[model samples]
Target: MDPAVLREDMVDGLESATKDVLQDEAVAVAMRDVPRHEFFDDERLAYADREHEVLGTRVLSPRTVARVLQALALEDDDSVLIVGAGVGYTAAVVAELVGATNVHAVDISRPIVIEARQNLERAGYDGVLVDCRDGAQGFPEYAPFDRILLEAAAVEPPRAVLEQLSADGRLVFPRGSQRQRLEAISATGDRTRFEAVSFAPLLVDGEQSGTLERNRMAREDREHAVRRAESRRGWEQDWIEWEHSVSSR
Candidate 1:
């Protein structure tokens, strides 16, 4: 069967299961347009409505992707920061909605980030920046994002991510150490909880060490990461304020 047909069927299942998730026309369109199969080697599992493990990471189910996109409520010109990019399927979908140049995806796993970049480029979404870095920091160079998405579950939505949101922006992630519940937060700090969801726990800096047979990052990419790290040091003051704000909540 054509992957497009498979994608449509996937969306159909999503819509039938939870109409609220596909209520956003743009989200539905992007979900249908992005080639989900391109990100998966297992064609059968790609079309299934369940999470599939890929390269030590989990490609979130179509249902979860749809809900995250719907919660984001992205606009065409919006800039987005996506954490836990996995193999970039969710980033690809978001790129279709907000345009490729407006999206940035980051992951702590170096091999996974490399795979995500390759997958996205092969899928013709090379414009979306995929970075290998600590997702907890939330990409400060791209601060004030219109939307932020976290595919991994955390004890709480990182305040750093909330700080990245522009005024009136939306952030979505599953929260809880165990028994996570998907939640959406407004830029103003109001949070709304939704259905229970499961995801790998968000790992930070040293906690993300892993060996997956991929070689070290290319020299140029390594240099870029170093540069970003240097700049990140300057964001510490802003991080302090964000931390204080969340502490009050």
Candidate 2:
């Protein structure tokens, strides 16, 4: 079967399953147009079931990708930034959805970046700008982005990324621990506010250990304090009940 046909089938399935979640016509078309198998390693192609992480890079599930693209609400005039773009599949899809000239995709891995560029070129997505850079920092050279999509998860929203977004621009990423919800962050004068939805966690490197440690300690402390407070409250309630019973007798 042609990869294009497979892609269209996937899109159709996704649209059917998530009609409310993804209503954008352009996003559906983009999903149909991009051949996802081209982005994966030859070995991984056999398992073309759904999107999964490969080589530390995630090929986002069609449903998830379609949902996020709908959330972005891309416009033909919009300039988009994709962080942690693995092999440019999502970038290619975004470029097709939002015009290739307006898309820029960046990743921290040099090899992956090179592969992405080649894949885009081969797929006739010449308009996309693929580069290697710190996914955490974002691509500032193309500042004032109308939309920013982080392919990976971050401990906290990066200041650099927030700075790159144009006013009213929307950024979608995973936030929170344990329950890492997909958050849509919009830039408002000097600050960014977000709303939580479900999304897959992104992988990133650097200072992760310290951040994890801090979060663990904070969680432990909160649990300890809650336990102690509950213990005290229970003891107080018991004493009150005993005093009332004795006085009544």
Candidate 3:
């Protein structure tokens, strides 16, 4: 299979399907520049009709990749932190969008990290850092990133990741359990806000701490009960306050 042809097809498909969805010329160019076939090991399947699933863990469809790149809104000068950087395919594509010098790809699997390094290098993205670490725990050593993308899904956006974003920085990932929704989180002042959309759930390893899981479930139930109580409080005082503020304005 010719990688060039496969890459062109994927780029052309993205160009046609996402022309309106993704209005960035740089992202379009980056899609065209990066060869997707190089990321897959199956030569015959590289250009096959099926979506490319890396290491049987993470799936990277052309459309999904395009959407992620578009969501990132990467600038040439911006630095990006990519979690769940499987085999560096998404990382390589992202590196193209944000310049190799400004991209760092992190993955938990050591061998996969090595594969990612090779893939990036093979795709002429040698400058991109492909590091091995627990991606759930954002790389604090390089905190305050201009942008962050988690290729895998999480029950909720990791607190560490939210803290790592620079002011106004964007973070995209899937949030939810049985029903995952795509979310775009942005850091504003000392707080982070999120907008929910939809995407496929990312493949992530289960938590190792049983105690943490039990505690998290308990906290979630408590929070849910509190929210229900608060909603039931009937906007009485809050509604009056809001009305007064609106009238004054």
Best model per lDDT? 1
Give the true-structure RMSD of model 2.
Answer: 13.9
In model 1, what lDDT does residue 186 have? 92
Arranged by TM-score, best first: 1, 2, 3
Error of 3 at 21 (Å): 5.9
Of the candidates numbered 2 and 3, which has the greater lDDT value? 2
lDDT values, one for every candidate: 0.79, 0.67, 0.66
TM-scores for the candidates: 0.80, 0.72, 0.72
Model 2 lDDT per residue over 165-200, tens place: 998898877666555656677787333333444433
User: What is the overall TM-score of model 2 with all chains considered together?
Assistant: 0.72
In candidate 2, position 206 carries an lDDT of: 21
Error of 2 at 26 (Å): 1.5
Give candidate 1's root-mean-square deviation (CA, Å). 10.8
What's model 3's overall lDDT? 0.66
Give the root-mean-square deviation of each candidate in angstroms. 10.8, 13.9, 13.3
Q: Mark the regions of model 2 whose C-alpha exceeds 4 Å error after superposition.
A: 17-21, 42-49, 189-249
Off by over 4 Å in 1: 17-21, 209-249
Q: What would the per-residue lDDT of candidate 1 be over residues 1-249, giving only the tens digit for each residue?
A: 888888898888777755545667778888888888888887678989888877768788888888777777788789999999899999999999889999999998878899999999988899999998878788999888999998888777777778899998989888886688889899888998888888877765433433211112234434543454456656453432121121132
